[model samples]
Target: MGVLSICFVSFVILFLISLILFTIGMNFLFNDYTIFIEWELVSLNSSSIVMTFLLDWMSLIFMSFVLLISSLVIYYSSEYMFGDIFINRFIMLVLLFVLSMMLLIISPNLISILLGWDGLGLVSYCLVIYFQNEKSYNAGMLTALSNRIGDVALLLSIAWMLNYGSWNYIFYLQTMSGDLEMSVIGGLVMLAAMTKSAQIPFSSWLPAAMAAPTPVSALVHSSTLVTAGVYLLIRFNILLVDTWAGQFLLVGSGLTMFMAGLGANFEFDLKKIIALSTLSQLGLMMSILSMGFYDLAFFHLLTHALFKALLFMCAGAIIHNMNNFQDIRYMGGLSIHMPFTSSCFNVANFALCGMPFLAGFYSSDLILEVVSQSYINMFSFFLYFFSTGLTVCYSLRLAYYSMTGELHSGALNVLNDEGWVMLRGMMGLLIMSIIGGSLLSWLIFPTPYMICLPSYLKLLTLVVCLLGGFMGYLISSVKLYFFNKSLIYYKLSWFLGSMWFMPYISTYGLISNSLVLGGTVYKSMDQGWSEFIGAQNLYMNLVNMSKYVSSVQNNNLKIYLMFFVFWIIILVSMMIFV
Candidate 1:
């Protein structure tokens, strides 16, 4: 069969499976049923190794979402990556990526989790570098190395758990929460989650990872790889809340959210803007999970997954039509040319802004209200509300630049939404983006949360959103005077626009000096002094000595006579001395 047919079949099968799993998850949730299956792998000298899988409502539902998204992504890739020589390879890599995520979702054992975790890191690296360019190679390296930090953290947690005589972390989270040593394990796990989720210092890789294909972005950034950290933290929430680690995460995630939102406002690359938005939402999930609201985080994770996947799909369609021009400056009036894709894009964008009754509103609005009701410090409070406004600001700015203005692309651009395969893939998630929020809200929370606050506090989200939308429009529609003022403050603009130089800090700042030092060592030790005194010098000396010996043995007549006379003289002297 053709690659396209294979992808279509996979999509249909996965879609059916997702529906079944969703139904089963609902049943499990209603009954509070958790199924744990264990198989003995080895037993020796009072230690036993086993593989375990947990099928709870959470895992089931999350798996359903993952599969659902993967199916659509595969279907989408059939068209997006069409006619590529390695289309088969791309499909296989995608399947492997999904498999790794499923393994992660189902396993409760730390060791087993590592299997899937490393798989994700490895497969994502391959996918990121699939285009075989220097940019993709660099991006893939950054992504792999950053995730390696988390892998090491997970390994440490596993070793620490070995003190408890098993790697199954689910059974021991409560026990580990109170013990000091176990708290260290918790800290290690939190560190791992931070790297995986791209929080604070480890966040540079998320935007860089856009070097991958758009289908991979839709899968990895939206529902699978990035969310793995949030999901891990959600699983470990029992040990995370009310601890120093949780507090640290809360602050870090808040700053990450703010930083990403600010960065998105400055980004011109269409994919990177969406990537930054994903980073912002990830921060939201991490922050809420740290605040002991795992369910809310999970809820947002699911809802975010729906719209984000759709958002990326829509982005893929636009980029595909634009001849791969991902810069927003090269795009405008696409709404008129590509109506279906544009409509889907706007829906996802509005959902991202948490427009009322959209998918994002149910979770994002609830998260904001919950934060307001909580007793967080003023700094955190500001971060929450300000970042919310920033989210809206970037979303509207994106829409304004890409969909509403006059046509800015070149004359040769054939901007149309004629790819039915891509559109069908988006159509599935578009429907979900419209209703997935309310649907998930109903399923996840059998009883509604009672949010009690004063009128002004209740209206805070709306007010911030309105102000943010206005600012977005203003920023995008700035006149020459304001633009000149921005040029004057170029340093500040560059700093904020560059994600506070995080990419620099992560790549050059972290490694450039070391690389320079390495070069110095290579020159002085490997090439200069060491070469002069070591192998090169020894070889030269040996060569000179060999030459002298060969000359003596050349059997030249004068040399032979002189050698014989010298030997005779030496013999006579030895005889006289005797």
Candidate 2:
């Protein structure tokens, strides 16, 4: 069969599967938990494999979003990757990746959940390396290796939990407690989460991951692999509730959000900017989820998947026209030529900037309100508030560079609109991004449909968003560079960007000392101690005996066998005597 035939078949299969899952999930959509056991994998007397489904308002909502967006990304890839030799392989991996994420959402067991989790990571890494370029391979290595560190901590925590309680998800919830040590384990698990979610010290790998194709970026950033960490926390919310670890995570998420938003403000590469923005957004979601607002966080994840995927797809179309170049400086005034992509890009960006009536506006507004309700420490308060400013600063920068600036004209025809299939996908997502947020009241929000925040806070958020858009406009108009004269901003960006190097630096120092110590120890053993008379004499006796035996060697197999037989008899007799 042709690649197109196979691709269409795969999409149809996935579409049918998701529709069925979506129906079942929606059927069980209550505010409380409902568990449907597919098969009993383990019991006291026997063990077997089975499938299961668990649903709540949050899981069902996010599952529906994952299935919907993932199906679109798959279809987008078909046309986007047409005529490419590795299209079939890429499709297979993508299908598996989507499958794993869906499985993770509905998993009734932590072990099964993790199986899906690792599968997503593995498949993402594979997709990162799909282009078979050196840079792609290196980025894939860093991304995979960094996530591995987190995965180890997760595995250890799960092992501890399983030993103490049970492996089943509901039973694990029944076993949940706020023990001090369990909080510590929770902290470790959050550490794993921070790494996987690309927070603070573990965040450098995310921008590096821009070497992947645009669809892969869409896949990673949009509600699938990158959001899994936040989903994990939400899945185990029973255990994480009312713990110091939860508090710590709330603070960690705040910091990550601010840092990532700031980083995206000055990024030159279009995808890297989105990548950093994603990190920050995930951080915000983590913070919100940590505060027992799983519904809000998952709703944000849902909207983010829609808008961000739209953003990346439009950006992908731009890059595709530009012969795969991603520099923001080289792209400008593209709205005139590629009207559809440009329109989608602008709508997505507006939604991303949290404009009212758009998806990001509702989700981000909910998060900010949740933060206000949950703030306890002065530190947390400052971080949460400050991150709002950075979020505006960066999201607007993406808008300014791509739509309104002076075009870099050196590369002729390196700028064009995407084909019908790609544009259709972008337009669909754009519409969803605009209207999806308002629907949250009916879908994921715990409260009824109404304006939910205070008037002053709403004003403040609107002012911030407008001010950010204006600031981006001014900066782009003048071609203002933050690092040119601003030493403080430079230092801050450097600090955040280079934070992941600490461990490698420490390892370098330790290895240097260890090598010096090892050499000294070897010298003493070889030159100083062995040079002494008695030690050298003892060593020489063994060496000389081996040398004397060497003189008795013969080329003839018969002679060697005769001597070997004689020694065997003597050795047997000695063994009997002993």
Candidate 3:
């Protein structure tokens, strides 16, 4: 078989394995059974070092979904990266990425989890820089360093867990809930999760990581890397449910959701807009998880993964046909040229907007209702609904720019949805995106949520969604008079468009001052004071002393005689004194 067939074969195998795993996971869920397998490597001082695996419905089902998404991604990449010389390398990296995620999902021990966690950070860095350009390098560095913060936090948590003499945190989560030390660990873990999930201050990297190929973006943003933090918190939900850390996450994630949604509205780059949407959805997941509804968070996570992956694939196809131009302004009337892709794109877009009966609707609608019924402050309530509206606004704005309106690109451009391989990959996710939400809602929840609210409150979600959609259409189709108004208010536009300067705050804003300080320190110490007092000054003194000694040693005849006479006189004087 050809090297390209490797990916196709892998996809088929993974697809079958995913189905089997899903079946097993469903059985486990129905039986409410957990299986733990452990292999002890060493025993010392009544403490044992062991590798532990936990098999329950949650891990198994999550793994199954992960594999399913990964297989489709690999299949898509075969066509997307078809002409590249390093296709095999790309496939291997993707498989490694999947393996790391699998390891993360199954391992119950902190030590083992770290192995997977670090694997994710490292492999993602490699994948981000796969293009080998300055832009890719900078983005890769940002992505790696941002994730490193989370890695350190995870390590700290593991160290703190040593107090309990076991790295299997599942055993201690219940007993350690009220403990001060455990709280500290939980805080560290939360910090780690925030970084991994790109919450608030750490969010810039998520959009920046669009440097990777589209297939990798689909996998990383949708299921593997970004979701790692949410999954970690899901496992540690017992520790976070009623704590200060949980409250902190709630505030941070809510703000993150708002920031990303608003930012997407102002973004022009197609991939980054989707990346921002992923960030927004991640914030939604984290926020609900913080509110102690981890099951809802997990549900949203799965549903989001399905549609978001399909969304990116459609984006990839569009970008491919557009000669790699990612600017949405350069795209219009694509729905006329590429009917199938546009259809899939609209489905994914509406699904993201939580259109009734679609995948996102099942989870996002439920989340809104739950938040509405909860006893949160008015500000939190506003943030929750306002952010939901923003989600719809951006989705519609994206569709308007790309799928509707007059053709914006050059007249000679050609567009078609002809890549059967690419379409086949999208087709799998497309089916899942349509039905995955209701299927998961039915399977995951044994009992339905009882959402009791007044008519106004119950209708609020639909109202906000409608308003958001209307605003999106209006904003995209602004009149020339309003365009002049936008120009007049350019500063406001710039601020909102720039993610409120978060990219600066995370990157240049944080590093520029430190770099200047480093330069000053280098001049004063390494070049100035150190040169005067250290090896340079010592070398000069040694050179002068050596010259004087050499002059004395280079005796002429007259000088030698004078020296001999002086020595004779000194000897006689000493003899007389004796």
Candidate 4:
């Protein structure tokens, strides 16, 4: 019948498909089977799970997350975009993206994986521009082009891997050390991963992607696209160990975590702050993966999915209620008007901060403990510790400013809540964020070496949370003049407040260096290409010479007849050739 009904049906179908996958996953956990579709070769081998190695613990965790987050997004969209013109189109793309990501998680070969990865990237590009605004369109273009760079690297690495090792995922793991080409291919593939995971130079597009709707932002940042890079690393972790690339990822991830956490300290825009925080959190996860702790990385990915999705959805509700203004300074005393949303946001924030007994606390603590145990090297130990503190600071800062500051006098008009659909989505996630850590420990990471943390670390974690929250409160309340002033003041506030500029700085530096190098080469060459194009002086001389020909350019009957005859001759020649 109508677009909304069709969209509703599609979402229902997607959920049913996800349920089937979940059931199959459970079966794989106990039984072995061969799956055949057309000429495709699919087999489940011996492991903790009889599922294909592609559907191991790592993929299952992320797949479950994708299904849950995607379903929530669809449910929320039905209400948020009830009367929108492109509701069906948006739902279709969303379903397609989810399907592609699911396929990516279970792809047993590099070729199949790349296909799914590229498909998801393409759908994300479309989603970013769904609003059809100039800003949304530009952000979509940037995300598409930047992600394509990663896709190219992935394709090249896949070709290299197939040529060196066998064309199967399992074969690569077995042959990694036996063949040098495996190392080379793995390194090249990791470069692509670094880009996809929003590490360093490729990190800029993510913040710009915030131009999309809040739900889309939540989906992209929390559970779906952003983790794709880290998931890639976890998928191929064993193959990447003992390589220089692995070491590089470790160091790179640490630096990213530290710097991005610092960057979030200055951000005022709600989404951009979380975007930077996502980059940092991913960096932390990548570091663990680099250190050869895939289980910890996977657990981190799971906990991150819970808390970060809740945070983003809560942010979405806040944005929706506040008429789409994402400035934290403009939102204060929300706990008074919207207690449930505020409470959900606060719990998720504390979880993100890794305060004791919270979802983030146990996951982050376990990761640090694993790192300390694995890398006896002091450098790795302290890097993780510093990152933990940074996480605490930024997460606390995020919760503090929005919940406890002075409400802006000119803040947006507020409704009581976003809606039942939106609340349902957020509430589900909030429950998970609160209890995900214990669930993760029970389901995965059943390692005997895992120790319960001493009470001192718990106390220290709470102290840091309180310190971070108070610091944010003081900064926001005391700096109210600068926080809300003239347009110029707002610009300065944004400048001081935005951490998304680092990528642009890198992008600018890249362009500037290229231009300078090109200029130097041009100046040094004896046979100048510029001369062949005709210089400014030569063009001026040509203009002067054209003055002499002006006398022959008179508009007269003879000139018109001459031109008409010339045109006729050309047309006649063309007709003859035809």
Candidate 5:
């Protein structure tokens, strides 16, 4: 422990303080209470811009959760990052990230939100590239640029809000409801949320971001960065309900959820599999929120944050011991060598599958029950249930291959579970994963939802869990020739193993195509044919007209007088004839 460790300790203190404040805020929830702090910046004629902070139960509680995960991540990193030259630098960036999240939580005005939003993007880019390697650099670019799309969308939302004569959108949620301008704002905001949350087209960057340090991934993927969009939707759910935008969300987020789940089943890289799980969980939150269940989405967000952070931490510990090996095929029987991490991993996998009263069960179980009660289309119903089923499928697969299979990482590796600092971090979150659901369910939903789901729907989770477990055992234990299949089958495996080619389309296809098209337009039109027909032709015409004028200007007074005399004679003759 050194100065860097001490700084992490200091941040841990700050997080505790924020948590206490949030706890205190719960007393004011029923009063419809909000605390607003503001300072006027400048006045432009009728409009005055001011910096404002809005503190409510929602913001405070969410901030508390974010801080809690961040503080744990910092503490965990003290050992994970121990003895590194730039450990202090990494800690500082994380602290800055926490600050940005807090700022985002408190802001009421879009301008203030931008301050935090942009801060998150910039700091995330810095953290993702902290390793200073080519892979990290490329991943950082993809992460930053993908998120920039949302930042731009947010800015456009702010621009659109200018038409309403205010930046405080909270006041206009109901007052300006159904206004065309507001619908446009809602659409833009939804687009922004999609990009931030890695829904649909923006999905590639989430898993790619696993190139960052594990602690960073634990914080970013599990809680802060991905959930930011879901949180924004929760805040704006009033405007989203009963809108076409919400339906679009239902579809996009559904596809994202199922896609990520399928991708996780194919992925073998340790961190990336977990990363895809995060993407899938993100999709789940977004999809549920789209159905007008904001509180359920938020509940799952917090609970998911607890277990997923623990999951990443466990993965980090295992990776740390394995000498940076991320392929689970190269790992097995890890529970024998690293019991604590293995236990944490197994518990997280169970919780993720929504087993009984684990943290994930409270929210995910509720999502399934509520979704079953609704009059959803078959497509939505299948996406939701199948995605939920797939969660169990992949999680069971991960647990089987990584924890119980024959050891393939070699016998002389000298792996040990003696990293107490890492184990301490996992212990904190493991307890939460085990019991956080019951506690959060009591706290957030004091009056539990009375679900009227059918018997078949009630059995759906169990059926899925059993089937997923059996399939996982079959896939891992049996010698399937998935690799030696025919070319047709091989192509199908490649398609899914590559995340439905989304990474290719979004990264290489979208970017390369945009650049190539832009270059073509610049050469063939802007610089070539358009130049010939536009500026060049106009310049030539202007020059020829000027030459004719100059030619007519030579000794112009005598010619002008002769013309004037001839016109006067003609006018006089016409007057005489009249």
Candidate 6:
């Protein structure tokens, strides 16, 4: 507790200094000056590997945000994890996670970036399993292996970029833009990003990772870990903007967004619901970035970080108060007990639903407007609109069950809206969540986006949002008495609750198939025919030959010599005949 308390203050102070420095540097972007800190690690006559760190406005702004959120998370944990013996380990892991993110942000070189990328994956795995429970172990394996796919893809991208004769990808992103080798590299990078960002086929891990401590979830899902992919794409936007892979990303991100909204509606775990919302937002960011809105995506990335981290902090407070209870069915009318936390949670939820004037609206509204005006197909349009509606739907449902509904239990409360350290952390983000969006828009885009759309399309978001919110409230308002009542739609409800069976697909479908195939191969080759013919049969034949030689031994020298001379004559005759 003492050490974490000290770390909380130390980290907050350090990142505040960084935020000031980076804000000043943002004014100097027009100077054509970049600070490059480079050192040679491996050198040869023909080729060499070097670690290069590039600092520009983009890197500075991102690093500053990462440090800020990370510091707040540390401060929040000072109380969230108050009496845990491993609190020191937790703080150190978080600091290491921040360092990895900083490394990823500043390094333009692919090899140097790997150090950060792999570190994020490793540290995240550690964080996910910090509780050392069975659920945490499973979640940790899923998180680590899924991210490992991206790490492998990145290594492949590096190998493909070797044709440029250097691992310094930043130096070649422009010159090799249209080159075939670079195209392959760009495609691989997109694949890597998909896995990291929790897009389809690699998406279940994001929600499952909620088995981790809430602070870890807040950090991993919000700014540092998942956002790494979007930041990577932003850096490599020059390469992806004109490729087939970009189109692939657009379609996939749309699906991911739609899926997240759909999943959150049926989810009951408070933290998992928030995790799903994060996934939906990630999908939005990836889709827009694919459409060449690099700055827009980056803007949302920043604002989302501000609120999502706060949202998790709010959830952490609730969970702590409830003695680690998470099911929303077990909670209701909590705002009456924990006013400060409930207010922050609702504000973050409103921001998540893109309420006007809040942090989510600036970027989300712009993204929708841009999609509405762009030459996108009808399928993409429907995805964006319906996903938006579902966001409202699920949020309303969450707010009802967790904040405004009748109390479901009679448990005594230990504390309410009174964790001063925790409340301070939430307040820090509360200030940002209120004005961060519009403020960032002013800074990042001096000119407002001129959205030209029919009044009908412009109101589409509002209409769908209302309908979804009404549906959420209406559904929650109805109580189903099911003690002896069989649900006819039980299967349908189960499907939606199970994230369209994604966990089943990723866990049983893919993993079981691989294991079954591996077992088949092992049985047929390793333990069966191959083992017998290669080793067992050879040993048996050698033993038989040895037995025959041993049985032919003689006791007398003369008899042995007579038999040896006869056998030699017969052997020489047979050899001559052959």
What are the per-residue Cα lDDT tens digits for candidate 6 across 32-79?
A: 457878888899997766778888878887787887888888888888
The sequence of per-residue lDDT tens digits that candidate 2 reaches over residues 1-578 is 88868866765666576567556655666435575657665666565656676766556667767767776777777788986998888888887888888788878676787788789779889888888898888678777877887888878877877666555555555455546665555666677777778876677677777877788789789888888888877766766667777777887788788777766765788888888889888988888878777777777888889999998898888888877778988887788778888888888877877877888988887677666555467777667666776667666676677777568757466556637778766766887888888875555544663445677765666676667667766656555555453455766656555433533442344334655788998788766776665678888898999876876674668778888999999999999999
Q: Lowest summed-lDDT stretch of 10 residues in model 2?
A: 499-508
lDDT of 5 by residue, 444-473 (tens): 777779987779888887887788677666
* Candidate 1 wrong stretches, greater than 4 Å: 43-47, 480-483, 514-578
* lDDT digits (tens) for residues 1-578 of candidate 4: 78657756755765676566656654554454434222334546642222233555456556867887777778777777777888878888888888788777777768778878998799999999988899898788778777888898888887777665444565557667556756876786788788778887677788888887777877788777888888877767876677788888888888778767767877778998888889889998988888787877887888888888788888888887887788887877788778888998889888888867778877787776555446346776666676666666666666667777566636447657648777887777887787878866765644545455567653554555566566555544546436445354666646544544565574456544655788888885533666655685588788887974674576678877887999999999999999
Q: How should the candidates be ordered by lDDT, best one leading? A: 1, 3, 6, 5, 2, 4
lDDT value for candidate 1? 0.93
The parts of candidate 4 lying over 4 Å away from their true place are 2-7, 16-20, 23-38, 41-53, 376-379, 409-412, 452-474, 477-501, 509-578
For all predicted structures, in order, the TM-scores are 0.90, 0.83, 0.90, 0.79, 0.87, 0.88
Candidate models: Cα lDDT each: 0.93, 0.75, 0.92, 0.74, 0.86, 0.87
Residue range with the least summed lDDT across 10 consecutive positions in model 4: 46-55
- Model 6 earns a TM-score of 0.88
Measured with C-alpha atoms, the lDDT of residue 63 in candidate 2 is 71
Candidate 3 lDDT for residue 265: 88
Residue 532, model 3: lDDT of 95
lDDT of 1 by residue, 41-149 (tens): 9999988788899999999999999999999999999999997989999999999999999999999999889999999999999999999999999899889988999
Compare the candidates by lDDT and give the number of the best one: 1
Residue-level error in angstroms, candidate 6, position 444: 0.7
Clashing pairs in 5: none
**How much lDDT does candidate 3 score?**
0.92
